[model samples]
Target: MIIGAQSALAQIIDIPNPLGPEGLTIPGLVAKIATWLLEIGSVIAVIVILWAALVFMTSGGNKERVTQARQTLWYAIIGLIVLLLASGVAELIKNFLTGNYN
Candidate 1:
């Protein structure tokens, strides 16, 4: 019991919340906001692109419009594939940082 208590004390770190004004610096706040904006913007862009494709698919093949619809669907698919690859890379980076072999 005494050894367990000593081990716990050694592992504890007193880190303050960096989001607090007193704790975070200007550059840190800017980086946090930028990260949030990038994530939100990516999600919004994906949703808009998917919605556009759905509308295009629902439209009957009216010559000129059919070509445009096909192009939109193709681009959306490519964008999604790119996002998937990025996600895979992110996971790989996360695992590497955490020293996870699996």
Candidate 2:
């Protein structure tokens, strides 16, 4: 059952699941999902940055390609910025929800 799986996962993570309880707490779920998303986002962002750099390096003086690479690099940088902001926001939300602020 889904409940059994949730409880098992909760135990593995050391989050409590009262022997007969239903599910993990909302904040715990949010934190777990946010952590996954942030990790994926960071990996994608790094790949994009590398791809953009490769494009820029291989442009070979072609104005259009150079421009395209520049645009791609700028977009990747923006995406990284957004991801960084989201990471901070996620931490804030998780901390607020769990009352674990510093």
Candidate 3:
């Protein structure tokens, strides 16, 4: 039964070929990596923002903790903004290279 289940799971998992019939070129791979990085950065920023908010809420009238939370919130916001700009720049570069700037 365990072997059968493992086989079923393996069959269900579709592992993509790095250089498949669909022509996974270097530029395409770089673009996909950039997109994944942007996605991960965004998620991290969101998590940091939420953690800062929680810290702020749980400070219990502590001035130092409140200040720390505020700083964390500001840093997270800045990081998120930077990530967004970086993604935009990456998209622009990709478009320029691919001649899709119409």
Candidate 4:
């Protein structure tokens, strides 16, 4: 009985493939996700920049607050740099895999 039930369940189940057939391959998927992340990251970076500017403006001439705001701004810049590089790398990988890396 158990064996018959297991066979019936297996036959009724159809698993979908995320990286095969009609969908994007692994590298292609990664590149697509990276592109989306870059777009989202750009928006987030802009918000962070605005927040950091607000912090600086409200620092009231305090050295500690000014330094904190500066650090936050710098960190945002660095995060953008990293995001760009990562997206670039993903593109390169996708191109190389697709044989379009001339």
Using lDDT as the measure, name the better of candidate 1 and candidate 4.
4
1-102 per-residue lDDT for model 1 (tens digits): 354455655776788775884778775675577567557757865776777677677777666666777677677667767666765676677678769969
Q: What's the CA RMSD of model 1 in angstroms? A: 12.2
lDDT of each: 0.68, 0.80, 0.90, 0.84
Residue-level error in angstroms, candidate 1, position 47: 3.0
User: TM-score per candidate, in order?
Assistant: 0.47, 0.69, 0.79, 0.69
lDDT of 2 by residue, 15-99 (tens): 6665226767766676677788888988998898888889889989889888998898888889889988988987888688779
Q: Rank the candidates by lDDT, best first.
A: 3, 4, 2, 1
RMSD per candidate (Å) reads 12.2, 10.2, 6.5, 6.0
Model 4, C-alpha of 61: deviation from truth (Å) = 0.5
Q: Which stretches of candidate 3 lie over 4 Å from their true place?
A: 1-21
For 1-102, candidate 4 gives per-residue lDDT tens digits of 354445645655579886667888666786677778899998999899889999999999999989989999999999989988987887787688779967
Clashes of 3: 0
lDDT tens digits by residue: candidate 3, 1-102? 354445645645678876676878788788888888999999999999999999999999999999999999999999999999988998898889889987
Query: Model 2, stretches more than 4 Å misplaced?
Result: 1-23
**Reference-based lDDT, residue 5, model 3:** 48
- Sorting all predicted structures by TM-score, with the top scorer first, yields 3, 2, 4, 1
